[model samples]
Target: MSAWLFDLGNTRLKCAPLREDGAPGEAVALPHRREDAAAALAQVLPARFEVAYLASVADPALRLAVLEALGARCRRIAIARTQARFGALRVAYAQPRRLGVDRFLALLAAHARGGAALVCGVGTALTVDLLDGDGLHRGGRIAPSPATMREALHARAPQLPDTGGAYREFAADTDDALASGCEGAALALIERSRAAATELLGRAPPLLLHGGGAAALAAHLPDAIEIPGLVLDGLARWAAVERAAGG
Candidate 1:
């Protein structure tokens, strides 16, 4: 039976299926709007799937809408949670119930890879959650993403032009200046959290980078291991757990 996983994030809804070998199948991204989600689901889900899992950070109303669209197409529909152990890692949230499903899933994936890790999700926002060598979550940080920084600058100072690109080591002009400013800020936030994680874990952990802006930031992160589908891998892992649990 095929497993379907949905990550309902703040900006977009990412959907993917787990192949028989438990790897992520092709992923589809759609706007967070209900209509868009319905349309995307209609196009992606095949007739043979037997199970569905949803990881949503959005409101319950929106989640219900997506479920409504799915409409008994699968035998089971499990909502992703911030619980369950995948190898060494345990979802370590002061309130695990309040933890974002995506963060929880990512930690599971990192633990499955086996080792200390700093899982960074860079999208509309930048979130870094850490898992120790023993797979114990040690908490993390959240900060403005590059686009959020740029948008804030533009919103506050109307004269700045909309811009984005790689930051030069030494910015020479206005464009580079803006890029460097935002890039430096983001890097500082990321590095500081990474440093703290290393100190806590007693060694520099491997950084697993994911999310929409990961590729853009990967070039600048010499300390991180860029993984394009880290979250999807986590989703697939969660699917496996749910199936085993008889859900």
Candidate 2:
């Protein structure tokens, strides 16, 4: 019986099978543009899976498309959702559904590692969530990601091309300036959040980074742990709980 997990983000789709050890196998990522993401999914997925689990943070259209595709190819499919509490992680949101499942899942995965953690996700939006050692979510913030910042700049100014940019400390050119400005903004936000989290928690939490743009920010975040497929890892944890509860 084959089980598969899909993590559909705003710009990319990631999928992999659950290994016997309950870990996701070598995952494959597909960009939403410059490629037919659905076709890639079809090509990569097995002919039929016994069960399929999905976590989506994209638009309704993207979610619908993925559901339609997976419905036909799997014996059963379950979509992960934002919850008030799961495992050791508890949502800070009074209205739990208002929180993004991706964020919740990231928090779950971070807490499972056994300590307070500051989880940062750099995807369509730069999201940071702080989870204490007791699994209490300390809320989080969301801001436009570097790519979004570039796109927004181009959309507003047009003269400043959004593409082709390099990050530099003191940028000498427009490209470098754009690159550095956006990335520096994100780095600054994370650093500030880490400091504030330390004060609130009475101890500094380990910074955990994930998502597509994580690598770009990793160098600047000296001690941040790069956890691959965090959302998927979280999904695996959720699935186990579901299976145990007789879902």
Candidate 3:
């Protein structure tokens, strides 16, 4: 039977099928607008699936729209949430929901892959969460993503056009400066967190990068392993566990 995995973010809604091995297949991305987000999901999704699992950090209204669309064709729809504990991963948050579902899922997926990992998600926001080899979440940090930073800069100074920029070590132009500065900020944070994780864990953990902005960040963090659709992987794992429990 076919099943679907959907990751709803601030700017995009990514949907994909689950392969037999429980990996996400080709992804279909649809832009989500603040003015009218529901239309995007209703327009892009059509096929019926045995089940649909989701992890969302979008507005509640937008989330509802996506779920409604999935409800139309999916026999079962499960919305993944941030739990205090799951499998080998234990959230550091005393109140799990305070932590984004996407972050929790990424940590779960990382733990499932085995070994200690520093999972960094660069998307609407840049989030870094550290998980020890023993499955204990070692806390995390969040900051405005490069894109968000750029947008903020533009908003604050309308003269700085948000569109043009290139990353460089020593930017000679305003565009390059903006690009490098924002990206560098994210990179610096990731590096600092990695260093902290290394000290706390007594060794350096593997760095796992994901989300829309991951590729750009990976270019700078050469050792970082880029993994797409990490949230979906965790959703699949959760679904499998739920199925086993029901049986």
Candidate 4:
């Protein structure tokens, strides 16, 4: 039976085929605008699948629209949720549901990599998670991403350009200063998290970067490993475990 994985976030929806090797195939991203989600999926998705596994962190109405579209093409749909434990990984959240499934899935993917990691997801929001080699989720932080920060500032100030400009240590212009400040803030947080993780774990964890905004920051962090398919990869793992248990 053929299956697919869907990751619906605040800004976009990414779908990919679940391969026989238990991995997610190349992902196709679609804008998750409220009115266009169904139309967008209809244009790109095939007519049928035996199962559709979804991990969503979007508005209810938007999720319903996508679910309606998937229902027409898929025989079964499985929605992923945050869990206190998944295999060896133990979530640090006292209330698992409070933790976004996207972050949980990213932690799952990072733990599968078999080492300590500082996982950063840079999208509508910036998220940083620490996972020990033993599959313990040490918690994380969330804040506005650089783009979101710029957009928020523009929304309030009106005169500040929402986009453009380059990052420099000492920017002389307003545009450059905005870019540097926002991007630097996010970068600084990631570095701080990494440093703290090192102190706690007695070793510096490898930084794993993911999400739409990751590439922009990747250029600045030479040691960071960018895995664009991380969440989908974790979904694949989740599917595998579910299947193994005959779910």
lDDT of 3 by residue, 1-247 (tens): 6777888999788888888987788888888765455566666556666888888999988788777777878798877889998876899999999999999888888999999999999898999999998899989999999999999999999999776789999999999999999999999999999999999989999999989999998998888899977887887787777667761
| Model 2 C-alpha lDDT per residue in residues 140-201, reported as the tens digit of each score | 99999888999999999999988777889999999999999999999999999999999999
Q: What is the lDDT of candidate 4?
A: 0.94
lDDT of 1 by residue, 83-122 (tens): 6455567766666887787888888888889878889998
How many residue pairs of model 3 clash at the backbone? Answer: 0
Candidate 4: tens digits of C-alpha lDDT, residues 122-210: 98999999999999999999999999999999999999999999999999999999999999999999999999999999999999999
Each candidate's TM vs. the true structure? 0.89, 0.96, 0.94, 0.98
- Lowest summed-lDDT stretch of 10 residues in model 4? 30-39
**Clash pairs detected, candidate 3:** none
In model 1, which runs have C-alpha deviations exceeding 4 angstroms? 84-87, 170-173
Residue pairs with backbone overlap in model 2: none
Steric clashes per prediction: 1, 0, 0, 0
Top candidate by TM-score: 4
Better of 1 and 2 by TM-score: 2
Give the Cα error of residue 109 in candidate 3, in Å.
0.8
If ranked by lDDT, best first, what sequence of candidates would result?
4, 2, 3, 1
* Top candidate when judged by lDDT against the true structure: 4
Which of the two candidates, 3 or 4, achieves a greater TM-score against the reference?
4
